[model samples]
Target: MRNLARPLLFAFIALIISVILSIAVGSVDISPKDMLSVIWNTLQGIEGSTQLASTYQTILLTLRLPRTILMIMTGAALAGSGCAYQGLFRNPLADPYLIGAASGAGLGAILSLSIQWPASSFSYLFVPMTAFIGALLTVFIVFQLAKVGTTLPVTNLILAGVAVSSFATALTSLLLVNASGELRRALVWLLGGSTMAGWKPVISQLPYALIGLIGLSVLAYKLNVLQFGDEQAVQLGINVNRTRTMIVIFATLSTAAAVAFTGVIGFVGLIVPHILRRITGGDMRRLLPFSMIGGALFLLLADIIARVLIAPQELPVGIITSLCGAPFFLFILRRSKGKDW
Candidate 1:
């Protein structure tokens, strides 16, 4: 407990700072003072009485707030799921997209974009819904391919994921080639941009994120036991197959929900959990929650850089993550050589 306290404090403070920065550092910069003032006023039911300009209030409330919230939720979801995946596979390199979730989601999003649905309130839901469905289906297929009789081998699961991910990526590229008017939009989304604005995304993603995060957290002890290998875990009275399946389902739910909205943001799960695992050790109970906080902090900072890096010309947040994550991935790969992670 003592060992966990300092990191927890640091993560909490960093998360708070990131949230404030995310909300305050957007296009029309709002000072932390004014941002807090407006929030306080709103919470106190005296929003109109605040001295802040209406434009500032509108921007803070209607735009940045929801965006920040969604980003936090998305970050938490991805990181938590990533940690679960790493534990489930007993491999430090595993990530939220391990089972073709991102590729499948991308394919689904492209399909929706190809249709070019008319701009309407309900239309925003189509892309996310379809992307989530695609992710679930893709996972189901991977599981089927990987299953040998009643048991699932981790090696086969990973191989199937890689193969299916390739197929899905090819399909996505094919669709992109034929997608006339929506080409640029589809590309931006594939590269990890939040297309929908305002609060709808937050509302839609909340349940899945909560359920997945909670479910993973609850299963942390089981994940720790599974690290002992499937045969030993089974001898210890753990239902290895059932536990693995539940972990996959929960991790996929969280990952799919996030990708459905934020596009294919890579390396978040890989980066956050791996970093937290180093600090907190391999204890899933500690690693999982801290990864959630660290993920929010990391992504909010990434989104901030995406907003300000080019000033006025915003890059996709996924681009920022990849730029940072790709090198980190290489470093992890090199470090993992000749050692058991």
Candidate 2:
């Protein structure tokens, strides 16, 4: 009962408050009551052709709403991947990028920006698709290199991810070095950006995040068992290798898709899981769900700070999180004595 009670309650409440807060606080001041009424009416079509106020509707439909939904999706995707990566490698310091998603995605974006490629310039949505393709390709290449017969060699997997990440960074830098003015746009994006979340990117991410989250949730029990070390898990009758592979694949897809939309929003994934671990211990069943909620609220609040910190000019949400996370990380480093590198 104690195990189930607190984490579940916190998860539910955090989601509710974050959603409301995300909608209410944005570039334009939106009172909660009016915003709720606007959402209800638009969703229910209570106004029909009468229409909501043009400014209100624009902010609600276009800016605030898309940003909020994107935040939720990105949060789930990162947090989910973070959980999988930490569990997969049995390393507390592990993050979603360990799979090569960020590296490949950065390469793709750098290419697009170098060529002065606007997403609209391509009929097939080249930038995001390119990022997705790069990410999937990295995953493919890593798996091919790391897999031995029917199972993955864990040591090899980690090494492959590191090698891929290093290669991607080198490639990204090389691209940026020779890039013309157009390609330079991607350079900022490579670091990460908060360019307004569009409907296409948001819709594209919805299915991937939902599928990955649902799949991970169903595998939560196996993941929990797998965390007890591979040898022990095998002794307990868990299909250790297969379960690990499934979770790794699941994490890869979610992180890649979300990164395609929101360029490299860091720390939400890494921070949420660690904080949740402190609160709930390292139980995957509790860990995964609570991580999702923590990710959501963390980003939602980060988004709010991003919007307001610079006033009319918004700081990228990733920047805000990094600014906050960097200091906390250093504090952690100091406290860790000789444990962390």
lDDT of each: 0.83, 0.73
- lDDT for 17 in candidate 1 is 85
Residue pairs clashing, model 2: 113-183, 114-183
Identify the candidate with maximal TM-score: 1
Quick one: best lDDT, which candidate? 1
Query: What digit string (tens of lDDT, one per residue) describes model 1 on residues 1-341?
Result: 43888878888888888888888896689987887778777788675554556677889888888989988998998899888988988877677577787788777766775774667555556766777678878988988999999777878988999999999989998998788777787777778877667998888788878888999999999999999988999999999878988988888778877887788798899888886777888889888999998888888889999989887777889999989988986887688773746
The Cα error of candidate 1 at residue 265, in Å, is: 0.5
Backbone atom clashes (below 3 Å) for every candidate: 0, 2
Q: What are the models' TM-scores?
A: 0.91, 0.83
**Candidate 2: TM-score?**
0.83
lDDT string for model 2 (1-341, tens) is 34568667777887788777777776678787778677777888765234445567667787777878888778877887788788777776677676576677666655654564455646225555566567768877887888888666667877888899789879888887787564444455555555635576677667767777878888888888887788899999998867877786677667766776677787877777876776767778778877887787778888888877887777778888888877886676577664521
How good is model 1 by TM-score? 0.91
